[model samples]
Target chain A: MREVAVVGVGMTLFGKHTETIRELGEEAVWAALQDAGMSPKDVQVAYAGNALGRISGQEMVSGQMVLREVGITGIPITRIEDACASASFAFRESWLAIASGLYDVAMAVGYEKMTGATTAQIMEALAGASDTELEADLGITFPGVFAMVARRHMYQYGTTREQIAYVSVKNHDNGALNPRSQYQKRFSIEEVLASRPIASPLNLLDCCPISDGCAAAVLVAKDLAPRYTRKPVWVAASGQASGFFEPGSDVTVLKPTIAASQSAYKQAGLGPEDIDLAEVHDCFTIAEVLHTEDLGFAPKGEGGPFIMDGNTAIGGRIPINTSGGLLSKGHPVGATGLAQIVEIVEQLRGQSGHRQVQGARAGLAMCLGGFMHSDAGVVAVHILKA
Target chain B: MPETESTENSRIINEKWFTETPQGKALAGSRCRKCGRTYFPRKRVCVQCFEDGRMEDVALSRMGRLYTFTVAEAGPPGFTLPYAFGYVDLPEGVRVFSPLGGDFARLEIGAEMEMAIGPIRQDDGVDVIGYIFKPV
Candidate 1:
């Protein structure tokens, strides 16, 4: 195995867009290539991550179609899908291609056009990520799943609704500093609490909006990284795991996240205390709380209070979601995982202006895809160092 | 007689999910004869023991405890808004995801719940009957 480094990262402003999926993919890819100081001809292999292209009328050969716009052809272009973690898996594969000495330079792109579909259509499509026959057919929406988890967490640990609502308040404040964020406006705790209820214990403000966007990253072998950029963010570790179905499993802790994060921490020869910052999956505000604990940043059942105390805020003990997270930054499904990586890369390279964690050297990114048997169906955890 | 044959305005959501035993309508599940693990909606093989042809059909308990729940204000197509659903932990160690009936406010964790069959939602002018849990 060899070392891999992220030389370039790019993302479109996450929100509603009239641009086609291919066009969105092109924008991010072009920006990434430009950032890396490389042209399309420099890429050896490409991986594209997309979840709802079929719903948007682009079903197969998504990678080929998207890369064709950037003049990236006659190469091994594979389409990867793993629900919301689609892009993260794509990045993992790209790292593998370089680490295994199969390719020196590889690119990963994740794009999703969710705005074009109807609310019902989009909801139905997102629900497909779960056990369609067992859960979706029973009409359990994503919010409902998280709502149940929030309720259980509250019941088990005395976590208050106010503490959970505080997560939205904090992330939106960070998003306000990010020009590319979807919802740049910050909200008060009372305002977030008073927002229209989507599911019990979780209001509208607590949920991430449906969005359309794209994010891309360029990775190369460590030995060749300095040729493209002066500040290369090394891929310390990349870990991915799927859920195990235990009927009576605890809903509060996502086992796959723990499994993946443990694998990542071990590979990186680091612990949670060593991380200077993190970008976790906050598809729902409660999700951030869960990931905080699952990633070992907070003790189990203490994530709500840990976040409520401002421990995870920017400039706090360990800043989290400086990119505004999926909540305020907007969750474009397939594009979310790579967007997280983009934020970490920028933070490590001292590119994030106001939201930057001062003197940060190491960062972590965690993403969850789908819910199954009362837990996340898939999880991916990655560690990056400056 | 099979429950589906007796109803005209409604039908069970999945025919293989329920069985009419002497004790009344009960959830049909598969038990791994090799490992004694059980599953709801049945299974072709035991996921725990990974033993083929070592599974037996069994009727699940009608009563269980509410593990967790939520009142969903919105859901996918065909679901009525503001409906309640939850996980019911049965004595067989199988957690069943079922729609909750009766007063939503009264639904509490660790509360005893009994399984009941009713219309869960409407599908193209017909009631999609399925199993539900009501406070006992």
Candidate 2:
């Protein structure tokens, strides 16, 4: 396969928005195009990711509808969805299109308009990401599953509840510095622990808020990279994996994340130590701990203490979620994956104002979609280098 | 026929997932004749060995050990708030997900748990009866 480069990336402020999906998509796409110093006509192929548009009333041809707002027409526009990992999968496809020599320039846009839906509607929609026949039908919510995982983690590893709450505190601290973050306020561990309970050991503060937003990126072939931008972030590797249902599998470890991140590390000819920073799927506070361990950033079962030790904080060893992550930045499911990519791109370019990891040469972005049989249904891992 | 009508009215959430054995009511599952692996809620094929047509119906053990659990303070429409649920590891090595139906304070990991049939949630004023686990 040929090499691909991320020439530009952009995202809308992650929070409740009155704007339609089309408007949000247009804002992100146009910003990305302008950042790439290219026009809409330059995009040869396009992929759009929107997870809940159908539930919000845009059922068919959402890609066509969104792209038309930016005057991007008459191209192969495909809509992709894998629950929360929708945008990362779309991004991987865009990179593949260029890497396969099929298209010189490709664009991926992910948008979700969730604020328009009611809370109950949103809960029902999000629950669909799990195994509907077994888990969802049994009235299991995402927080419930993660709470169980947290319990298991604590039982097996002796992880304290305060250690888990520290993740929320650290991410919120970082989010406070990010202009695009949904919640720009930082809270103490006491406040987080005292927040209203959503699940035992996991309060409302530990969970990511429902959000509406969009994120986009432009990719080009290696040969065409210089024409778009001087500081192109090369796509070192892109890895994707699906969950395997094993009844007795360990709940503390995410098998798909390990598989995907290992595949990415191998493809990039690098190890977890080489990663300067990461933007992982922190849909919940406990999730960040699990991802940290699964991605090899920390030893298995020690993710709780690892974060509590200030290892994951900005300016610490291997700063993580510098964009505030899904917890503080808000998780707009479909948009979350590419929104992660947008953060890594900016950090790599040394453009992130306060949350930037200095001299960051390499970064990893990981996103997970759904849960089933005690595992993530899908996971996507991408490595980027300056 | 009268029992069938009563069962229908009872609205046992999923009929295929349970069976009445001489021992008692047990969760109906599938055991792969080739690998000897068992799965709950049954499977058309052995996901592990990918062996098709070598599956046989098996009754799951009614008793298990509480593996992990949590108390969900909120949930979707039908579930009563602050309900408890978890996974139970059975002797057959299959971990089953079930709603816990016992004293909240008595629930603990590694404690003995037994499968019980009861109303899991409400659906349009109807109790959706399904399998649950109670601390023993």
lDDT for each candidate structure: 0.92, 0.91
Q: After superposition, how far is residue B111 of candidate 1 from its true place, in Å?
A: 1.4
Residue-level lDDT of model 2, residues A1-386, one tens digit each, is 99999998989999999898898999999999999999999999999888887565796789999999999999999999999999999999999999998999999999998887776678778889988878788878888889988988999999999999999999999999999999999999999999999878699998999999999999999988899999999999999999977778898988999999999999999999999999999998999999999999999988988899999999988999999999999988889999999999999999999888999999999999999778899999999999
What TM value does chain A in model 1 reach?
0.99
Chain B alone: TM-score in each candidate?
Answer: 0.91, 0.90
List where candidate 2 sits over 4 angstroms from the true fold.
B1-10
Query: After TM-score superposition, what is the CA distance of residue B49 in candidate 2 from its true location, in Å?
Result: 3.1
Q: What is the interface RMSD of candidate 2, in Å?
A: 1.1
Error of 2 at A273 (Å): 1.1
